[model samples]
Target chain A: MISAKLKERLIFIGPLIVLPGLIVAWPVLEVLWLSFRNRVQIFHIDRWVGAANYLYLFGEDLRFASAVSNTLYFTFVSVGLEFLLGLGFALYLRFSPEREWVKGMMLIPWVIPSVVSARLWQWMLHAEAGIVNYLLQSVGLTDAPIPWLSSPDLALHAAIFADVWKTTPLMVLLLYAGLLGIPENLLRAARVDRTPPFRMLFCILIPQLRPAIATAVVLRLLDAFRVFDVIYVMTGGGPANSTETLSLYAYRTYFQSLQFGYGSSVVVVQVMILAGLTAVAYRLLQGKNPAAAGDGPGEFHPRRTEVKE
Target chain B: MVPVKRKPIFRVETMARILIRSLAVLAILAGCARSGPLPDENKTVHYYQFSLPRDREAFDRLRTWFHEEHPEVNLQIHTLPTSSDDQHQFYLTHLGSRSLSRIDVFALDVIWLAEFARAGFLMPLDDLFPEREWEEFFPAPVQAATYDRHRYAAPLFVDAGVLYSRKDLLLKHGFAHPPKTWEELVKASRVILEREEDPSLNGFVWQGKQYEGLVCNLIEFLPSRNPFLTVAESPRLEVDRVRRALGFMRDLVVRFGVSPPSVFSMSEEESRQVFQNGRAVFMRNWPYAWRLAQQEGSPVKDRVWLSPLPAFAGDASGGKGALGGFLLGIHPESPAREEARAWVRFLASPRAQRVLWQDLGLTPARRTVFPDLPSRGIPLDVLRQVMESAVPRPASPLYIPISQSVQAYGSGALAGVYPIDRAIRHIESDMGRIMRVMH
Candidate 1:
């Protein structure tokens, strides 16, 4: 015997749970199961190995350590730079007279598929014939062309640079929306009191945009941590695996090396790390912005208002 | 008022009918999608191979000929990505499922024969071909296709790395011939670089990118004993040779400065571009580069000459190049086993090989096809010599992991990122781990 309200809630929320369970949870559980077995498909070896795969990854595989470090470096640096650049761009566009036109143009980099952009960067970073080198040499910046994609010292940074270029616009879009959600009257009131621009940004705008910033940073961090296409197209984890990230390493193990169990374990560990980070990030961000957890001026419920309309 | 009250019920009935009709259509569409396109009267045999845009016409002609010969069999061609790594991944995903019987026949790299054979993906060809038929192809490719004394594939074509030199550059430097040994090559390159005084010019170029090509280059650079062979027999002896070989490769760029710093990044096409543009004095590449270099308007077209790769001084195995090329194998789970066998046999036939060579510049695996064909400005005799001395990479089911370990460590050593000794140690350990786990 269900109440009318309870039955209505079940009708609305039931599919949301079942759909994700079927599509996402099932495959994840399968991979978890696979991670515990010694499954080398090519060798026809499938047996319960328990923690051996994880042990080997942590203890014996030097590449796995490097891959973890590379992934973290790529994620933090790329996401950090993107947040800063995106915030700056979002603010500038909000105030600029040609805001719509500039915003549209800013989307070109983000709009292009990552694989295509990576290929373009690969050509532009070509040591001998690339335009970047040509410009650098012509300006007397350096006599020899920099091996952007080839040098082990510089390849990961090159990948990060590409990631930043391609993804910063997403941050801009999110932050810009966050900016728009801010009540104009608050800024008007601050201006009436003779508030300085810097103070307004630090004390008002940033505090108001905390939720957006956190969401954008976490989203980009997760995406960048699992980055494969751009780096794959550009360096292929080469010049001695300097650009190899966790996802690339896992893929190589699964597909190229045919070590399904080991690859699964690598991915499982990566997922655990991601989950921990996401939890910490959500908590820290939400702790700072209590309004995100309740109905407050900072929280914009567009859907609720639209539903009433 | 009564008619209006009944109108709502009628509308509901019509709406439900439309919904049911659309859902039935969707269900039919989904069924079609699952079983693939509508069935044809002719028996279909699916074939998968890498795309070669340049040889599309030749391939079409071969398909037409195949269809004419076997009118009952419908040959469906599917093109895999050109990269061997991608193709290998595609096969692994498709064949691992054991349900993708649509792929009746596929092209396989020589090194993948052992792995695929061991995985039970490929059908043994021992019953398909007799002793006389097997003898038609070269021994190297034949040997490469066999695992546990059972032939698993039919060699469709063969490739061997060869040295391409600028005849004009060598003559200008007062050399009668291309370098016979690695020592002579370095000396000649030094002299040529000094005499030419061209900043754009490089002494030599080869595939040094961190991939399978690097492994091939490593094999070519090693001393006559073959380090890979010694690894199984005497691991101690292999270590020193591998170190020496790797050191010399690094020295060519760092110490001699002849092979430019950029060679660390160059693959076959990039190195060929340098040599073809007359910026490189010598290049090490596969036989395919010969046709490209001799094409009209190439800067070094008339001046280029092909020769065997140089070896260490006094090494008897100086001329050996790494064996490469593709073979055709039948899927063990394929429903149309007879049709797949026919397709593989047809592709490896002498007539088919001749067409592939004449039309597509592929080096034929059949020894008989080489006798009567016009050379078309290519040095056939020199190619034959290189092919005769061609050595295959280490034959093992674990070759992919082994190759990956070699490429990673070797590239690290070449780039000065990892010390040579450390790289070697990593390689040995990685190989040991791979072999242990697989076994």
Candidate 2:
């Protein structure tokens, strides 16, 4: 009794569903399986260690704990700063009358490559003859030159500063898009109701932009957690291992130490952390969905008449 | 909307299809221009060279020299960080890979050939160069290059650690000449410190950074002590003499106060700059600084003096300095292995050696290059003295770990974190574990 067109539609969608399963899901599952294997020498699955690698990481490797802590510290701090800055920029751009050239000019930092940006920052941060120290000294801010990359305490902060410089523009653009998509009538209504600026932002704008913020936060958090290139170029985790991130640790384990088995375990550890964070974010977003729905009026009826008008 | 125009649109579509087909054919033909199968005989040579920032010009010259000799071969050169340990990491990555294209020729440290040869990274050079050609080279350097009765690399250059002093400072200290013994050196440093008006000025400066230099400085003084680096007929380390050596370094920093407190962070270049700026009275550095100090516009252009590292308690054995230099090793993966060998042989020839020495201020590997040349600004007798006393670092695959342990443990004492004895004990135990694992 099925129509030919309907049957063809079902047939067309069947392959699409299976294609994603075959491409992405299947490979991710394979990585999960391989991570449990004892060794990956020559890509052979020699034995099953059954969580022993994970156990050894938490139990014996002190560097694992330090790297994990450092990664988390970077993720939260840098993402938080970038979020505030991006939100502020998005608000400013949304309210202000935009000049065409100004909009184009704001995209420069985001457009440049991360490696090139990092190298530029590195030159500025050099201890002896760098511009940063030169300016600081000229202003009489401090009597001595600060060792930005040379000191353990300052190295991580320096790396974070570089990461913020390169990535904040991305956050701003995403938030700006979310802001533009917000209905202008809702904001106008809030102002008419005598709602203050802060209250309007918290009650109307933020609830509406929850989906966008969640998406942007997850993306930026993932990037900050796995920040490798800038840190690798800046410090290489020296001055007594103060700036060691999880990715750099994994790299050293695999490349420098040549312990592929252990290195894979480190990678698995990072993957688990990222996956857990994503899951938590998903649940939080889902939990807030009900609140977002509550802000809207009853929506069972379609506004066909209003649309026609 | 316009039926008459539809005919023209259909005709244009047909013409566009024809043009697209023609363009595709042209693109394929252009790609095919260079897509023919590579010949079986052609081989690519991948050479990895590690050098300092100052040697970029010399490296370019060497590149041109290599290119002319092998016109048919493809050549790749990888410039690495100036740090030798970091360069070793680059080698580790390639050797760990199962691929042959990773690298073809590795310019190795003289001491590294032993460990690398044992690890199967280096190909035996007997097939490329005859024994007589190698015999003409210095025995000690050749010995340093050999492991397990097989020659792994040919000596490329010789770097001798020497005492660099300010000639003006020595004269100001009531001594017209540089010190030759530990006692004399310390006395001169005290005199200079007493007379120098600036509080920031240092009497002595050397590499105390947590690196191979600390171990080298410690080893030079090991032979003068009662114990030695190794036990007879055993691989186990001699702990007591090693402690004495560590103790001596600590005294140099703390008890003597001749060296700067910031010595813990000073590398070769930093210490050199400190001395070259006329800030320090004496310095310990390799011969490369001789050229830099003599270069135009140097602050200490005419004020620098060079001599052997002062002996401890006037003992020759205690003053034994470690020989450091680069060596050339053929990569097992080199496609133009025979051609690469010919070029390497040319590089080692007396003609090339002499040219490198006279023109570039580079220390040549061959003994003949030394006796025939009386290069201006470098005293010939000083060269002979360094060659006679050159000692090689300990050859072991465990050297990497040993060097790290030495750096980590002794760095505490260098930074005034722990006492010398405590640091020595830590180093001994660390070395023990490393040796056990490596063996």
Candidate 3:
């Protein structure tokens, strides 16, 4: 004999839970499992070699170190630039009274596909026949056309600049949302006090958006850390492996070299690094939220719903 | 009360039986799915290939010709990306999974034949293609598709690297013909470049990117300096010879300023676009470009001329090229192997080769198809000479990584990222590590 309640639960909710497990959980678990085995090729049954793949990459490969450094450098710089530019633009939007159209207009680059933006940037930055070079030479800023993509020193910067262009718009919208959430009463009080504009900006606006800033920074950092398409399209990680990231490294190691075990180890390392960084970001900003009244200590509690009676 | 109790029990019994039957049916379906799809009765054979204009047209004609010959068998041609590396990577993952029904025949790059065979992706075709049929095509191409005395692929069309020059430009500069030697080429290009004085124009253009093309370009430079350098087992390149050759290429850009700095970023198509746009005096490309260069509305349509890549100044027998071609291999795990074999046999026939040549301008693998090459085309004499003199890239199963290392360091040296000496040492070390780990 079956209980009606248990049967109904199994018939309906069981599928809803099991379907996601089959699709998402299975692949995630497979990757974790594959990271331990020494599967050099795709089909061959490989022996379990616990942490050898990880040890080989971290210990033996110099390229791995360079890749990690490059990834971190690229991520930090790209995110930092996006944050500064995005906040500045968002502030500009806030200061202006009628700029509803500006938000939509600025999203052109963000809306265009990453690959398209990369190709467009590449063409515009070409050594010859590029409008950028033409302008540089015409203005007497440079005697000759710059080899933007060809120069090992300049290629990474070019890629970063292109990335900043493509992603800054998204950051602007996020910060704008944060800026809009600032209570009108708070600003009115600052105005009533005749607070200096710069002082109000530094003390009020900056302190108020700490939660948004942290969230934005962490999200942007994670996105920037795994950037593969822009650099791939722009420079292909070359001139001399100047712009290869961990993701690109793992991809090549996995697909091109057929060393799946090593590649998975690289991916696992990357995931751990991102997680550690995210934790650090959360901890540093954990106590800065003045709006929360002992609700929690280590949570990113936005003050959106907080009220003063 | 007793009758009511019996009825309820019977109802429960019926429900239990129904559930048991449903579970058994579901189990049967799951097992069938696990074992993979049953072989189809209509016998559709899938041919995996890459798309180029000539290849597309050639296959279209062959598809019709093929159906006329074998009415009972069905064919499905699937196109992959044109990049050889991409196609190989696709198969590496696809065939590695051992898909049962998707692909039957694979038109693979000649270089990939060894890797595929070694990895057990391809079936041994010794019985399918007999000795007499194997003896029909050129020996070098056949040798390329064989590993461990087992023939794995049937040679399709062939390609070889050639030097394409602006004949009109060379003639205008008082050179009656194309340069016969690398030294002569440099001297002539310098004279013409100085006279032309166009900032956009470069004297020479070639594929200098960090990829397979670099190996092709570099191999042509090697034999002139060290004639014994071959892509055979235990291959060795003389250090000084490599330096001289790479230095010569670097000098064209860094020393003489005849080739552009942009050449470092250019691939085959980019260089071709430059040459065909009348911005470059010379180009190095394959036979496919010869056909493309002559297409309508091309800037250098009537002015382009072809020849073997130049040798060292005095070595008469030193001009060599990279032997390039495509071949078809049957998937070992394919269910429709017999139908696929029949398709391969038809394609290997000389009649198909003739149709391919006539329609698409593809160079045939068999020597017999050449005598009847259509007259209204770019002269085949130069292509024949180049093909005869062409050499193959290293015939190793680990060729992908080997070529990647070469491309990376070779382009680095060419782009002045490292001096030639340091670049060679780096290449040697990296290649050694890669080979040691992989093999």
Candidate 4:
């Protein structure tokens, strides 16, 4: 027989569960359905073409391939740099006795909105009148000013640098929390054992902070893979489409080109790639620990027994 | 075991209390954001428009006048994005839906007439705009507003591509006249650049970005040779003429080095900035730049010279400006057709045309409205010549995709990424595919 508590919980939770289902899942499901159907004329007519859109993305369009590679390149470079920088900052803050004030100041870049940050970076990197060029020229770096936004080779790197600047603070905050959660006794034990500083980081500290590193990297990877605003504001995916990320490509196809059939396919491919990466991340983080199997707020296990000062 | 002081209940109570208080405050703030709803009205005309930089003051004046005079009709104005690409996409999102949008009147770009009309987003204005009334606007703008034998819109204003030059700079370099052809333009620019040792100064500047501005630049160049080939006849593209014209454009910057590589990052305003500061000897831009160049504090003030965009040396059409203008149309799904039609009629009137000319410096689409104004300035004379000899872009329903293809390939050529010949071939083939789909 069902307990009275169980029946009461079901009655309370049923409507609450449906709220998220309606808000998020329903639209995602609708777009998924649209991916299967071919939009013959605007959104009025639809013809069923199962997996045809997916096949076209892989087989037919060179733009889709280029966009995929560009997105991956952006993701890999951006997340990798952010990780190293964030870890470095977090480690410094942890070891330094008088870094509380500096820690607050460092979060300012992350606090500023993304669009505002992007526009600021765009002005700073302006080829003719920007201060960056002015400084470079004053120091006798080169005789000619660099075309930061106009050149195909330089546009991607300029945009990547901007993304790295905007996101590294987030990584620092997350990794700092993980750094604090480490037990003091363990560090003392390592000190007693005379373990080298690098070994302590790679073997003990990093292994224990696996969950936070996983969260930070996966979040940044997902965000970077579909980058739009920084690239849009700075390069506009131009100079021979050098900085066109997957999100910008999908947006251009759906809105500018008015090709719903193909645009939805781009979105579907992005989702598939993100899901695969996330699953791999989850598996890697779970490493011999079944209790810490899930991601996100409620599902994630509290691995810390004590918060070190 | 030690008895623990577990304060979970008290902590939960405090959090719940704070959450409830914040929710109430947020609810009050949300209410403060919105005023009372409008009263029930029979006619509510929602005018949707892209926000042109120069037209804001005129738009506000017109909106106020229309509302104050006609109390029975609720005339509201909505501003779309300034960028044409974004504005086009915004309209498509609303108009492409299965249901009717709330927008009653649409102030359209000239290139959008074919697309919106073919898609049935626009109501034919043949009934609303009679022949006598339609003939008031210039023929080129009228022609641009027409599609499938139906007048889809009434012309609002005129914009034609023109070349702006510094008269003092040219005279200093010993040139008595403006360049009449591509070859002459290059020769004139080179001489000026050689004499002026300023690294900031350039021979010429124009928009070369991968956008609609880039398409405008390419269009001004391409048709001067054949004068007959257009994307309207894309399947039968003249590859050789296109190659020559594009080669001329690319050679201006890449080969000749008259323009900076940064031109690829510029639009109309950026190029204007380069020329208005006396850094550029000449700039290819629209008539709006004339007003800005003639501003009091401008470095090139009173030294400005305007001319028609130069053609090839042997071309029949001398300095043919590409046709560009605005059109106002009615939405077929509008519930307030009467009010919307009245708004359109008011805009096309003599009073409206005068303000558009005098206040905003937008070249009036009406022939009789600003006939005497051309005699007032040299720029006005050049403007008149360009308007008279203008050629419209291909009135295709697939203009968005067609223009995208041109921007991609054209920008490739200008950026030195793709060779001019290869770029021409790609544009022709891509445009051929678009034409087949259109047919």
Candidate 5:
């Protein structure tokens, strides 16, 4: 009963459905199933414990609570700083006379692998031999060396600083691309109308770049949420677990502790939290864009959309 | 309209072509996914172990010896990551996936013996060594390699914590011998720091980091009669002694002001670097630091000496170093069980142990090999004594979690983030919970 046209359509679309189902959906479902069991692989303890793991995480495990707070704090602070710094760099690159060289130089941090950068930062932040401490001491900034990675109060922030340094270049690249996409005529018109630079930035440039900013922020937010390598290298969630993010906690539980079921539960909750964040972000970012509402390419046309003038 | 009609036909043809090519690539990939090596004339046995750059020459020698010993076995050696944590994770992933046949023989850290054995990842090695043969290796490492009264691995090499001191500094400060007790160490360090009046020099440095090394240091700090935890019956932490040990650790930083605040972040390498640079009066580390301290370019060359770690003044038994080293074991699921056992036996032999000691500076687990090697110095005698007194960490299948609890709360206490009593209570309760769940 299959028509020739329908057969062709099915042939083209079948892999798209089958591939993700096998690769992504299957593992996710397996983990979700595991979350409901009390499965400690080493001990050969496997049984249905329905919500017991979740209950422990929510009601009892103090480490889980700290991990949640640490993840959120790390994600938001690092992403916020990255956005501001990235926007500033992007704007400078767009207007600077030495744009090509400056852009190339900015990519050094991004191009270096995160683990290497983290190790580099670890050495630089060492309380005794670190260049950062050495410089600070020489400049009479502080008498005692700051225990950047060792102190519980400062370890998470130190990790965040490393994360921002490594990833800010990515934000700059994306935002700069967005800047390049803005139509030239619109900015020319703003200049002709005698609009101030600040006003033009807020009214003309920002509104035009909303889609790009949203994309960059959401991308960085996703990356920052599941951060593992930098913190793993720098603090190892140590100095009393102050820098322990959810991903690190899950890794420690699943791999180190061999509490596979509880670890899966942590993962499931992390995914759910990430999903909720992504959805909210998508709605908030795409809500105002006419292109997102299916208004077509003409939405960006100067004549079709109202100009502030 | 004619061009648009042709577009659909063009798209269909291209899609079908792409699909065919993708299927071919995937089929080729799938063909290559078969496990284990191809069948060969010689029996293939895969060996996995971590080797540092310095140990490469020694390992090469051992490999040549192994090949000569077992020409019928095709021994493929794989270098694992140097970090113990990474190597542990690598084994967990492969073994957890039930890909057991991929690795026939592997080296395990001393602390991982019980955990790996209890998980049924290792082959029982009792048949490889007789009761008398077991006595050839150090008793501590032999004890560590056993689980549930069954031997699971063969001791390869041994390590124990020792105190490395600046010989000139101690003598200059009027101390004729190394400190025999913790009280003497503290008093000597105070005198040296005051008379030397060096702002950059620290009185003592040891691993206080929140890692397995911290547990090792803590074990050495505790009285020999009282261990941090006992797993003989139900697991229990000796709270009072642990508190006193942890209090002493914290006092070194917060009270004594002898050890740097940075000790809270140091590992073996960091502490060794400080000692080698001659910036610390005394350092708690392993025998390997001796070779490094005496290296040609080291600032402390010829001026450093080692002794057993100091004990509390009241304890007559003196200090106890935490035993550490690698052990060789066979994978139970490997089809080449005979070859795997042979490989382990060859590696643990006295000849191989001597090569390892002479070339790599690792303390051989075999007591007989010690006499065969040339005399290095007085440090060799001290290492032998320390190895005799070395105590193994608790032999429990739940050692990883137990260690984690100790590292977290213990470091918390040492870093002044948590009170010692509270940290001890937390560690005890955590261990109790771990035992209940795993049991």
Candidate 6:
């Protein structure tokens, strides 16, 4: 007969062994393993050259640098604008008389598929026969039509505009949830005490909504970091690679260049950066408590003591 | 009891039993997956053919014929999109995976054999074609199929960018014939565009899209001096000659304004629609447009005429017109390779060509088919001349990227995003970089 201790250990380790195996852990490990190798061909795989792929990406390849810069630029600008607009909409909706119907209609942009939106935007912005150009020219704003997607300078900005339209609704919903729980009595008390509109909001409202704002920012930030499909189908990282992002760069290396090893390296770098940012965000959201480290109040003050007494 | 209490001590016997059973299961799975080279009667040959809207019926009829002729050999045909670049991407992805199965016959561009063959995706057909039968094919068509002294593909169908015109419009202008040179064609097109009642109506509708179709329409002027970059021995372009040729084409849209901004959005169907509705005085397209123009309710019905694209002026020698055609290849992974070979041979034969020509209105690859059959309404001399004169694009692996870059630069210039000289220099620089990597 097996010992009880051994049986317990076996049961404990069984899930630990199989859980990660089934959840794409093995494939990820394989990519990490291959990332170290150089010049993998159809049948033969070359041996390890530590950090060569990493060096190539960071040092030699201007494309990768451009992609990183563009990705960061897009993420911050778009998310920043989205947050401001979303917060404003949420505030307006909080005070507005027609709250339910107005809020329901506001979700329309968020519900539409991104690909469909991109295609619609492409048609509206076509240089020759597009509606935007026709209107622009008709009103005597400009003599000629603007090459919105064709201009390298404006391609990324145009893509950002399309993305912001789609994602702003998400921000609105998050901020709206935060706004709903702002303790209306405290706000009334402050207003009765002659706390001006700006002062009352800054002092009483925003502090209570900190947790919700943090959550929304984290969600938007993470999503913005991995932007691919919209920019891909729209500009294809073209007009002289002005709008190239890390995801597109990785894809080109993997598919177009057929350099899986180098592509894996790029993916690993992105994962690490995202993971680091997420960890920091999570810490900030949980209030960064030192006393709570390996100890919640429940750990210190047990309910069993009351039972014993 | 004490002995029994002592654990099995990591016994090899039990461990061996578990290992053996697992191995047995794995072996069974492996065996099941292999299927051991399909049974002779069940072995099927699959071919990758491009899917164009116009060829759906023809492909179906061809499949039915192949099945009847070789009942034992099951033939599966897969259709890809008409865009050559898209189709090339599919092939590239599959080939990179080293999974050559599911394709017995690979339909490729006439210019892609050299690169594909070198890449080991194509099977050479040196011993497949007999010496005497090779002579029957038009020289240009045969030359297109041959790369580096090896036959990797067979020219299946021949297409040329013929000028499809409105015969009634020409007659009204007191010109019963199509223009013979670039200058004459320009004058005729100008007159039609200027006099047309509708402002939206165009005099010429040629492909100016940022894709392979651009090369098909624009490269006709390349033969003003020598279109092919390399001669028999050399491997470098006569750069100045090519530039001059490209200049003539650029001037057509930019300088003349004969074509429209809408041309940038057009493909084969778009161009065909423009001419078929009498909105265009002339359209440059493949032979399939002939059948479409004759269909009922077509505005240019019974008033359509086809001729080779006009040559450049001041040229005693012929102008360079692009040779457009498809090539059939056999996949190395095909189970029924032998039967697929027979099918390809039969399809390439004059008998099949005649049937394709008569039923599908497709031009045959063989020169003799045009003269040998009375039912082929095309004049024998004209067919021979087009066959002899057609200049196939450079058959390199880099052809797709190079051609795409060509379209990108040319379209950019036509759209007024860049000047002609700047665009040409950009193209030359970009192509030079790609070529260095290729070499």
Docking class of 6: incorrect
Put the candidates in TM-score order, highest first.
Answer: 1, 5, 4, 3, 2, 6
lDDT of 6 by residue, B345-377 (tens): 878878778777777665788776776765444
C-alpha RMSD by candidate, in order: 6.8, 7.9, 10.1, 5.4, 6.2, 11.1
Over 4 Å off, model 1: A1-19, A290-309, B1-45, B54-56, B63-74, B127-133, B225-237, B333-339
TM-score of chain A of each: 0.90, 0.84, 0.86, 0.86, 0.93, 0.84
Computed on C-alpha atoms, the DockQ of candidate 1 is 0.40
For model 2, residues B1-439, the per-residue Cα lDDT tens digits are 1112324546878899999999999999999986978634436666677755456566567667766865666556677777776787767666648464467677888757766776677888875667777877766677778776777788877776788889987886679888888778878898788878777588888876656787777666673633334522334556677777677666777888888755655668878888888878989888888888888989999898888887777574645456888888886656678766766676787877776676566678788777788576877678657766677776665555556556656665655556767666765654553343232
TM-score on alpha carbons, each prediction: 0.88, 0.75, 0.84, 0.86, 0.87, 0.72
**lDDT for predicted candidate 2 compared with the true structure:** 0.72
* Model 5 residue B408 CA deviation in Å: 2.2
* Evaluation by DockQ, superior candidate among 3 and 5: 5
Native-to-model Cα distance after best TM-score fit, residue A84 in candidate 1, in Å? 1.1
Residue range A218-286, candidate 2, lDDT tens digits: 899888989899887776654444577999878866654444555677888898899899888767855
How high is the lDDT of residue B157 in model 3? Answer: 77
Return the lDDT, model 2, position B33.
84
TM-score comparison, 3 vs 6, better candidate: 3
- For model 3, how big is the iRMS in angstroms? 13.8
List candidate 5 stretches off by more than 4 Å: A1-18, A96-98, A183-185, A287-299, A302-309, B1-45, B54-76, B94-102, B333-342
User: Model 6, B178: alpha-carbon shift in Å?
Assistant: 3.4
Which runs in model 4 stand beyond 4 Å of their true positions? A1-26, A40-45, A48-56, A281-309, B1-44, B52-74, B93-101, B127-133, B223-238, B374-378, B420-439
Structural RMSD, model 2: 7.9
Candidate 5 local lDDT, B154-183, one digit each (tens)? 998999999988999999878999999988
lDDT of 4 by residue, B242-329 (tens): 6766777778887898888888878888898888878899899988788778877998989978899888777886777778878898
For model 6, which pairs clash? none
TM-score, candidate 1, is 0.88
Reference contacts recovered by each candidate, as fractions?
0.59, 0.02, 0.36, 0.42, 0.48, 0.02
Please state the CAPRI-style docking class of candidate 2: incorrect
Tens-place lDDT digits, model 1, residues A32-85: 999988788767788887887888778877788889898989888998899999
